[model samples]
Target chain A: MPRYGIPEYRLPYEMLDRDIDVITSLGVKIETNTRVGSDISMDQLHTDYDAVVLAIGLHLGRSTRIPGAEHKQVCKAVDLLRNITDGDKFKLPKQAVVIGGGNVAMDIARSLARLQKQKFGGVKVTVTALEDRAHFLADPVEIKECSEEGIEIFDARGPQECIIEKGKLKGLRTWKVRSIFDEQGRFAPAYDESDELIHEGDMIIEAIGQMSDVSILGEQLTEDLEWNRGRIQVDDNGHTSVEWFWAAGDCVKGPDVVHAVADGHRVAGSIERWLVGRQK
Target chain B: MTEGHSSDYERLQSKKSLAEILEVAVEFERTARDFYTNLIPKVSKQIRYLVEELAEEEQHHFDLFSKLKSRPDIEQLIQAMVDTPASDQRFSDAIHLPDLGEKPDDQAVLQFALGREHAAMEQYRSLAESTEEGPIKELFLFLANEETLHKNQLEKLYYETIHSGGV
Candidate 1:
């Protein structure tokens, strides 16, 4: 639990697994490969355990619905990072461009830099974001590493279209971002026409954000549960409206590993306390 | 807000004069080095090592600036801290002293690290703006880039500390 000065952000999947093993060894039971809503039914879980805490994370990547976004070379930033961390190898293009300015975008950019160095002997990566450099949501350190690794950063550029020629990705065409959010704080981007740039790249990765997949909750349970925006609603203790069920992690709070751990602790304590109250 | 002094400093293009810039850089590096050195004794051995490493890096910057200052084309100017008078004597009187026994909390340490990185970034930005020479501009830009990287590293540490619910 003491992660002081530990490089947990860029840790490999196997290292995370090992860390989980260490936690499990400390008398906390951990189940693996058990897919909820598939491996077991909700009714069955309700009958077996007093409370079911859903700690499933946000895995679905937000996509840019620009023209030619369906091109094969265009991939989600999250997928690219996950694949690279899984030790998978592929022949990347001589030049690559990542779109977005979040932490995940930086992670992919840095990961690609490492790959580029190992294979090509130099860095040829570019990151384009809608926000100005100062307003970028990504931790400043990520931006710094991307620059240090020789990646060019083009700020205040919003993707207008993904250029494709003869079934091959040629580059991306973007307009100057006038503003990212609307007056109402919604995600409506205003672009400037006079300022436009075409960034040449064989591959483009989108890292805007991610969303939860609660479809497995089924229509009945989903309708019965309280809602907040598109996420399932839960109390402070990770309790759902239904007494037998709970939800936590990225599915409830979005993507963050430490948050998931905290959510797990809260739900576990709540379940234990509820069970004890029932016994009394 | 001495308008005449501000105008004079602005016109001098202190940024273009490697010697003048180096003087300010040396002073900044010395102050940061002193801060870290003094901070080391107040913390645990692990944190002390980190602060010492930072102090050494600051010393390296001081040495680099000193070498730059010795260049023939360089001209000496009063350091920024000396030129701009502030109520807080800590800014003016701070020395490159060794660490005392006051260990800062994790947040405080992170704040210090952030301030250091911000100063380095600002210094490089000023250097970039003042210098017209190509090589000197490039050098300043490169240093700025490096400072940004350091800033990021510190920020990651800060956020991770917060994520861990802080000790």
Candidate 2:
């Protein structure tokens, strides 16, 4: 089994590991460290197998697009998580600011809290988001745990700019978010200018969203394949317009581990059926 | 309730033995007891206490069945137990003892117990329907009624939590 993306949630990791072990025990040769659309060449894949499955997950982090977002200290949430999980040592600042309200934001905030606890004898990770506490996207259990761990959370804040002083990190300026989405279901945050706060932080982590990088498909193949709102268009069985290529996982259905697993199963079944039919 | 004559009592009793019904009753009690025990740790302190009481009620059911099992003529009970449907097999299998090490929070536990009570009430109702005549049928009906009572109590607790934000 191919393990892509960060592994923090234990359920999918445990389930996938168990399944891979079981499948391997049954005499299936499962290759390891082969990242489709990246590490392994598509040419080699086409030459070796009749069909190629693209399960390359969405790892591209979304940007906040606020002023001073390009600062050296402002890092993507995924990168930070990957670095932490890989046991890489970094000098985390005394105060850190996390931007977003999703589960990913919660995970990074909690992880940073633990790290700060270990380093500074206390946690000083602050999470700010457009959504209120009740409307937060993080699971209630996660929110409760974060509160229990003493991580500071500020809700309904729309980031305006990262404050800098003499080319040094100072803090972040945010206006109170009156509302996040517009009437037409678009991202148009309305902010209350009167209600403004300057949150002091040495580092800022963006955990807004993620997308797939399809640039590796090359300009020629990109035009040849069907596209649906920037995502690769696939049939019900995960079959792409190109018969030889099948795509699944986060590349096709966004970043959900269970959805990826379900997509894999569907695409595998479809491939098996197609191959069997061709033999007949 | 009208007391029947000896001949009427014999006629009703002889239709199916008491031994069979007692067997099924024992199984149902075991399942209910296991479900309650499993649910205790998942609920709040008050809910846990309530579930413990439910488990005790299941023990009472077991004792009732045991008494019926010791009767001289239990042929009706035996027949009733034998004819019990396989639908309840799921209940028997799924009724796990509580895992004390990793207790779920209060809301989860209460919801679980509430669900189990609803399922048990349905199962007992079906069991009651499968029996015919005399004390065997009466016993099944009595157990079913008790399950309904437990279900009502659990429902009340569930609603109370929902409205009061206790869970």
Candidate 3:
């Protein structure tokens, strides 16, 4: 959805229904409305099948430790996009401040701009990011088109806090970002504290990035699984530490559809090879 | 990067200079129109008319963009309108351009053209969202509506050429 320019609308009803029809005709039973860690459990899945592969993607958005970040209007980009895609009719805010400089930021900014235009007759979205424009995380096309779409893009700006007065969001207090990387090229950001800018808005959205959800593994199983750098450690073939359990997709890699598809194929191949060897 | 380009882009985002936005918009419109003019020769006569029609509509949009850019006092209304919200119903998705090699078939050419018009329509609607009310926004709406018409027409042509044309 973010890579391809298509926004808001998915496939026309007939086409989507047809696609679902075809997928279902393949004799593969599919279930929607069920979620792991709650509606379903990994233990149940493993007991029902000989081998289990965990492909649970990262759905949680990273939050900042900034002051007043817990305001009701402060939200994640994914949550806002999901709400819009889910056809939620919301009263558009007078101003929306989006924190982050990635494609997800652009997605939220642009989508909200459309809604604001329909509701108020003009766009009022300001996107503030840590990296400067030259080093922005979002695709250059997304940046340019978003600018052309009238979304305010602020590069090299770091969010200090979500400003609130009288229990209401008033603006986002930010500092000018001096450097996004350390001398060793780490992800540490250096900001100019003296240089501050307060972007007034009714809402603040964090689009910095996303993290995977691994709670479905449960306490015992999760503790037993070897992990690396906050992600499940998997071999080149996507095999987890546990012989019978494997991991793939964003839970193993990150948030990317193409990567998820490639991971799916690799794990499938590994499963096939293992099954054949066992039979022999 | 310019010394204050970042700050400028931020300030510019909420309220853009009317002429600058229109100028860029004109370039995009012209590019989309010229896209068809260049692709017609690569396609057979079976689809040339459809391409020509698309090109003409895009050219009309280009003319509209130019006209909107030239208006006096547009700058004054620009700040106000730009501050106001504008509606856009057009949608966009990723699309690939028509490849010149492989002696591409009519179906491929039609599909590419269909995607192009779809993108153009979506672009105009998006531009409308950024543009303020009055003539400029109206111009964007006009061009966007025009692109929608072109997209629908192209969709029909594609349906006939593909579904009815026996693949």
Candidate 4:
């Protein structure tokens, strides 16, 4: 996440290097460019190590699963963020319609704005979200900067379809959101279908949420592991159902770097206690 | 003992040309790859996985060196040199799996791996310092970074596996 998730403008590579240097300075050895599942199996980790901690953060971007969401012009904000970070070349859009009201949505929108400003000499990005401006999931600073970059914000809109014309993306059709949650506080959005509008754009980006890639845990291990909702279940100290196995970070908690770091500390303490007991 | 090693390094450094140095590097990578590949089956599944990765990296290094050798401006690339101590195969040669006996424990294997990675890091750093700003210099610097990461991983594994109390 540090390398490929965050933009260089936000968190420079040198800053990351310094942070890593701090750990290496403490005589902590780290391996890079190694995939845990493919490079080393869970079974092997269980056999060899005293304890194994999974800090696999949320990587895959969640889809809105709305109609025409599978259009070629439709993309995920997380994937675009990663692509931008990696300096991967893609056709910069003249007009972009973002489908969410979160930091990730802002990140992609701002990034696209920057690219558009660079390539097309202007910013033409529209952010459409179900939440009202008062209840935006994104940070206020991000929302402010998103406008400062000349991107339009269309709050209180529920995405209905990716408006396509001649097999090409024309814009995003959205309905005016009446209420986002049900009476019981469930995530059932009530939209005023009568109130609809189409925000013209060449691209649509969905940044609603993120989920961890648990396929790395392997089939048997995944089935064996306990889960709370979609997240891996863990004790207060980060210990899992299996005694030697532990989970922390965005995979268990949520998508915040501070929380992940705190989780790391918690897991370390838990593992230390478990190991001491084992030695006894 | 240190003076003797320093003099030996000087002698080797002075006697070798760019092509000859690259040839030695190629040989080093090949040996390291073969060493890791052969050792994989003898170790535990987890260690074997690590060794397998190390072997793959060594092979990559070998390809990089080979490509560097075939570069048209290879001979003229070394415009400057730093007076850093260049590492040879002396450190790696001093250790062997056979010396640890058959069925060496995980700790012993990890320690051995750590030592080799340290040697590789130094060797690449030495190579990096010997060249001016160009692909050769960049390649060695990249290699040095990779080796440092490899050393770190081995050390981390060692601490976690052998000294679980502290980790």
lDDT of candidates 1 onward, in order: 0.68, 0.69, 0.70, 0.75
Once superposed on the true structure, which residue ranges of model 3 sit more than 4 Å away at CA? A1-22, B1-167
Writing each residue's lDDT as its tens digit, candidate 1 over B36-114 gives 7777666544244567777887788778767665654333332322121121133223333333336564445656666
- Predicted structure with the largest lDDT when compared to the true one: 4
lDDT of 4 by residue, A25-135 (tens): 999889777787899888888898888889877677766656788898899887888888878988788889998888878888888999898888999999998778987
Could you give the TM-score of chain B for each candidate, in order?
Answer: 0.64, 0.61, 0.64, 0.68
Cα lDDT tens digits for candidate 2, A92-140: 8789898887777888788888889888999898888877786677778
lDDT of 1 by residue, A142-215 (tens): 78887988999999898888899888899899999897654544443568988989999999988775655565
User: How do all the candidates rank in terms of lDDT, highest first?
Assistant: 4, 3, 2, 1
Residue lDDT tens for model 4, B3-52:
99999987756544556556666777787788778776775442345567
What i-RMS does each candidate reach, in Å? 17.7, 21.4, 24.4, 18.8
Better of 1 and 4 by lDDT: 4
Top-TM-score candidate index = 4
- Poorest 10 consecutive residues by lDDT, candidate 1 chain A: A1-10
Give candidate 4's total backbone clashes: 0
The TM-score measured for candidate 1 stands at 0.58
